[model samples]
Target: MSASTHIAVVGLGYVGLPLAMALAEHYPTIGYDLNEKRIRALRQHQDHTQEVTAEQLKNSALELTNNCQDLVRANVYIMTVPTPVDSNHTPDLSPLLTASEAIGGLLKQGDVVIYESTVYPGATEGICADTLEQASGLKLNQDFYLGYSPERINPGDKVNTLQTIVKVVAGSTSETADFINGIYQKIIPAGTHIAPSIEVAEAAKAIENTQRDINIAFMNELSMMFHEMNIDVLDVIAAASTKWNFLPFKPGLVGGHCIGVDPYYLIHQSQQHGYFPQLITTARRLNENMSSYVSERILKLMALHSKHIVKSRILILGVTFKENCPDLRNTRVVEIKDQLERYHARVDICDPWADSTDLKQEYGIELTQNPRADSYDLVILAVAHDCFKEDAYTPQNFSREDGLVFDLKGLLPKNEVNARL
Candidate 1:
């Protein structure tokens, strides 16, 4: 917790970057990543992720590095690398393993290695510890300690930041847990909750997103059923809200790093333990299919309006996963575009928050930050980025007269929008 302690944060993305920046306020931090571009940008005080601003980066005491040898300067190592899935939706552990090996090379006696990425219950101890032991030639629990502090970073949220949100910390041992909790307590003004063990912290993190995914999946199913019955899902939800205890979860495309993918990690781990994760898997499937369903609904709405379907030029407003953010790792908005393309519709995407290269690399689709509003026959507001709602970005000079405007996430006025999901 002291400024004398040099900390190493591996994989400087959404979760790790913010954490490193926060820790840098009191500790000399090393922000390490394998990506040279990210390291270069960080050194230049230009974070493309936008989680940390240029001025904030300039003020930070965090040193950016790519080489594993550079991490030897720090004793407290925290891993925040990705835990993405394979094309088959299976948990891919390659990134985690590679990070563990990298950190292990710089391991010193009495150093603590903490994991912040979402994983199965025993992943921190089983996979990472084993890799560390093999790579560093250090015995577990004796030579070095392990800890888990699962990240709870909501991408677009400005209110619940690293300093404000309560951090959950746990460790391989009680002493380790206290040390880890003390470190996080320095920056986390909302305080910390020390779990019983590292596995409990892992389980706690996975369940947080899993619960949200299931709630949204139920709403998505209700949305589909209500659509068939010619009832607006939002309207029904509003009516249902008259009851005191009604949960007001809305229906939309479930995407991004946490909600769209974390449940699968739990499901895979559960299955590995000889138990099927029924409700969790069911919710994942239902939420995963929402993009295609949304695309079809758009087509049906076009047909209902007697608008041209195949050759019509469609403009998608936002491409990022969530509103007001730029992190586009596993956005499901691309799925809607894919489904629409199958119907022979020429869809032009525009997201002020997303980078064109990320959109192309992740989904094989091109996104224009400056879209020609005149050519769009239909404008589908997929993500409610703050720019889209502003008068300057609304493009009043364009086809507001001759096009159908479909607000999918209900970010705009109901009277102005033609339809909503």
Candidate 2:
């Protein structure tokens, strides 16, 4: 049988919003989120994540709702919630569990629930399924079914949209698998890859980001080594690019929902299966320390400029993890601010993309939306956001007469900037 006509997409953030918008082209889709404020904003064609443009939201036939009762009509429910870590760095499955419970309460017989949240293997079968069964009194693979379609949504990435990227879908049963693939194939122009089972699909999804994380971690380590040798990492990468086999992953702070966080899911699963992934764990550690490393280097740069490291005014150019995107989840840029504050350095953060209230609430770091130019002793481009990179070309007055300039992403030419990581 083909997929159902009604679909419900839970957690309307970066991932779900785009998917829901695309699916709405073919089905009567309900874009649901618990946040009423967000739903209201979406109804008025405002996307807080900025993934969906106003025109797209207004033109789409999708219904945005905050009520769980409103989703009872959807036969296909997709969960696309954020899977962040706790303060101790352990995976926090609370968001996933909460979303599952919300769906479970509205789940009807014969309904199929799919998950796009990144999790360790068995999460769909174990935690989510259990919640569904308890909430709806439905038996998995009997009264209802479950599927796993890992989200490839790159927040702030304009090139890879829902239709552009190939989606990986797997179901609890063969019939369900085909049905899910058929629905996705209609919208995702890149098509779908049906895995052998849901577990394989989950494993495949986790590794996609894990592999990138490991690759970037290698580049990050190389950046540290090159910095010690007084070599520009980006220049070395440019030289290496002449070789066909050389990977083009550059070194910078590995943040965002996927690269910085998804590896832990693989780590958790690997450990559960009685195997420790040494290389993956080591790469994660290396990437995690890069923010602090950048902070230390900037302090040393201040010392070289005949300025005292302590009690110096330093301005952080970008707070968002990636360039041109406002997403701040698991952002390592905060580490630089925290480290600078420890040394009694006045750290002023300015990111045109970041929401000042959210930054203040999450990191306890107040943001200056527009700090005056060239008013500080040091300026560190922690994030290579397009706004900051553009700011590099136009000189600022925030820095002292002979200020220390540290370009973390090597965004500017060698002669234009002082140092790079």
Q: What lDDT would each prediction earn against the true structure?
A: 0.87, 0.85
Cα lDDT tens digits for candidate 2, 1-421:
2244699999899999999998999999999999998989898899878998999988999998888899989999999999987766678999888878878988777899999999888888988899999988889998899989999988888898788999899999999898899889999999899999888988888899999989999998998898889888898999999999999999989988888888898898789889999999999999988888887788777777678878888888888888888888878888888888899998888888888878988889889866776677888777776655464423344566777777887776778677888
Give candidate 2's TM-score. 0.96
Off by over 4 Å in 1: 1-4, 242-244, 395-400
Best by lDDT: 1
After best superposition, candidate 1 residue 47: deviation in angstroms? 1.3
Cα lDDT tens digits, model 1, 53-75, are 99998888888888878889898
Estimate the overall C-alpha local distance difference test score of candidate 2: 0.85
* Residue 378 of model 1, lDDT score: 85
Q: Which regions of candidate 2 are displaced past 4 Å?
A: 1-4, 389-397
C-alpha TM-score for every candidate: 0.95, 0.96
Using TM-score as the measure, the top candidate is: 2
